[model samples]
Target: MSPPPEHRRAPPPTDAETLCRTGRKVIATEAGAVAALASRIDAGFVAACQTMLACRGRVVVTGMGKSGHIAGKIAATLASTGTPAFFVHPGEASHGDLGMITREDVVLALSHSGESVEILTILPLLKRLGVPLIAMTGQPASTLARQADAHLHTGVAEEACPLGLAPTSSTTAALAMGDALAVALLEARGFTEEDFAFSHPGGSLGRRLLVRVRDIMHTGAEIPWVPEHALVLDAVLEMTAKNLGMTAIVDAGQRVLGIFTDGDLRRLLEKAGDIHAVPVAAAMTRTCTRVTADRLAAETVRIMEGKRINALLVVDAAGRLIGALNMHDLLRAGVL
Candidate 1:
């Protein structure tokens, strides 16, 4: 038997060598790409922004393969950040999706080489429709670049891929550049959190940013409350019925006087008194944290977290109890 094929283990790299070689190469490549972009921010970039801003229709982004994936993400980011945008695969655009593009819209095409045949095939039709073109590519002199109304160069010194055959560093640079453009436009248009929430109504950010306290609070008969003169047993029943771990103690006018919680019940049980005979008001916490109905659900979360409490009473400007919420409500609403 040929001496059992000798086993070899990869050598460990020294820290300084790793930093000086691999780390430095990546940093240098990305830095060079970003630095090159600074001077390249010419009239073309401004023209691209202006065209997109002036568009009466949506921004149509198109690319092929890896560029297509990046284009899809860029479209989503733009759409959520105040710009109405969507992605169209260059191959599909050449087929029938080209109908999606309108004369009033702007087209953003992506290709590292700027020579993707799929993308190039649709250029003529876009031009015929009078759609302004913004090309993002590594080759500034390629066909797409030459044909575009604006060319955003995304050239890098070298790719992070070991074989330099993959679209690793180039894709990252393109994604970052796309983010820069989206954020710039978002800020220019004074896009607010509410605007972002409208685009992402199904997400946690939307719940936290757009949901108001009143929307989630238990109101009307759902609120677990008892008169200040109610027996401790009545408060316990109210807390148990509501399952909120607490009950609000209110006066006759529905103004919150104090809050009686499971903690108060526990402490009260240890005292030399009958649970049924004690007035809940005597055992309630007088200084409970309260919020307004108009407050953001996110703010309510912050107040609860900061105060180390699980529930809050919603009050009006005059301090009358309007609603109540527990941590469970926030969690269920996707605001936590």
Candidate 2:
């Protein structure tokens, strides 16, 4: 009387498997959508970059709902990458914020459907103000794209949502396209690391790219040094007084002959044989790690970590000792 096994209901998947499968599907779907965009980039993308590069005023970015969030991030990336830009809310634009935009600027609008009522409301005014409008939309034939000076297609064939309603794959495509646009403009403008640091002065990149070794190094009398002929006890006294944990043993020309550190003292103490009577030149390390004053202070981190040492002697082009810095100096300067 029972039905065949094939006709019966199959066992449900385990909860863990269900969750993993769903997560993987979303990621694979979105990844494929982004990958597909590489072939779609064409003349419109170029026109957008050209318009952005030549803009006399800021790039005004706007969108509605989920697209607005993407638009704000796009504006930020463009601004930080040497493109002048900021975001304006489309609803706010319909109010009085439209005054923030001017004829000299370029407006980049985002709308997956190309028919966001809030965005469409201001199209005529933007046109009247003579602002160049660049549209990033999923639908190429829609109003926003049709009216735009240049249209970038950010379409995705499928949404990662099970219901096919969420703005998942679409938003990812839009964000990737915005990044492409920013990078294109960055290349066209010849934006440099120093230029990026200006926008991010409070970030680590600014400290690394903008700070020079001379700015934080102990220069002049602060440089700890002893004559090459000085005894171990004399060099140890110099190191203790200067508190740099080391001293440069220099010649009459102030050229560094060698360096003696607390580590070397420790090694000598282990031997327990006339350690203090040894000449610093004999006990010191002849090959000292040195940097130039023009070098980036941030570079000290790599050198110290790679060489397993904490101090550096800075020399001039003429090979004369000019300055010195330690890990402590880098820490104080916020370069570590």
Candidate 3:
């Protein structure tokens, strides 16, 4: 199956020291390229941001080859950080996908050479639509850069590739510029943690911010509790039945008066031995922390961890017990 010896030749034996030096050289070169992009974020960068911010429609990001990968990531970051954006391949744009572009949309085109044939092919169409164009390219004098409303120069002294052919430093610079643009737009719109969580609803930050205590707390019969005058034995039975490792001591009207925990039970057994006759209220912690049903579960975790407690009782505005939750509940709900 092998056609040519030149194409089938194997690589030389590895040199660990040379490989390490090469890795460091690549990282240093890429870092320098990214750092250089910061200085170029002047008027053109501001103009690009202004254009995107003024657009009523989404940002349409287009690129070819290696630039396309960076464009997709930039699009995702933009979309998640409050700027609506999506990626469109330059090649596909020439094949009827150009219809996706509209005057309402802001076009962000990425091409190191600034003369991608596919992108240049649709440049006229974009102009015809009167859409604002923001070109990210290495060549300031290239056609794409000259025709755009704003040009972000991503030029580097040299690529990290020793052969000076592959897109190592150029892609790094482009990615850094993309991140800077996304963050600038995010701040301009005053995007908050809650807003970010809304876009990442499946992530841990979403769970912590959006999940309320009431959503995960045990309710009705599932909540472990014993009457204020109930025997310690009864409280132990309730804790075992609920498996919450603790039980609330409440009055007949369901107002939480105190809490009896596994730790309290252990301490009581060591001190008074026979809890078979002891009142639950006498053995309960009178200063136990309780929260309202509507509080955030994340807030409850902080309270529990700070106070060195495991369980908490949930009450209404009138101080009547309505629900209960422990560390285990929060953990299960991904709020831990």
Model 3, residue pairs in steric clash: none
lDDT by residue for model 2 over 12-64, one digit each (tens)?
67799898999999999999999999987899998999999889999999999
- Candidate 1 Cα misplacement greater than 4 A, ranges: 1-39, 270-276
The residue-by-residue lDDT of candidate 1 on 1-336, one tens digit each, is: 344446656577788878689877877776666666777677877777887788889999988989999999999999999889999988887779898888889999999999999999888888889899999999999999999998888877778777898887788888887887898889888999899898889988988899999889999888999998998999999999989999999888989999998888999989835787888878999999999999999998999999999998999998899999999999999998
Model 2 bad stretches (over 4 Å): 1-14, 270-272
TM-score of structure candidate 1: 0.87
Candidate 3 lDDT over 132-206, as tens digits, reads 999999999999999999999999999999899999999999999999999999999999988998998899999
For model 2, what is the C-alpha lDDT against the true structure?
0.93
The TM-scores of all predictions, comma-separated, are 0.87, 0.91, 0.94
> In candidate 1, which residue pairs get closer than 3 Å at backbone N, Cα or C atoms, i.e. clash?
none
Error of 1 at 59 (Å): 0.9
The per-candidate count of clashes, in order, stands at 0, 0, 0
Quick one: best lDDT, which candidate?
Answer: 3
Worst 10 residues of 3 by lDDT: 5-14
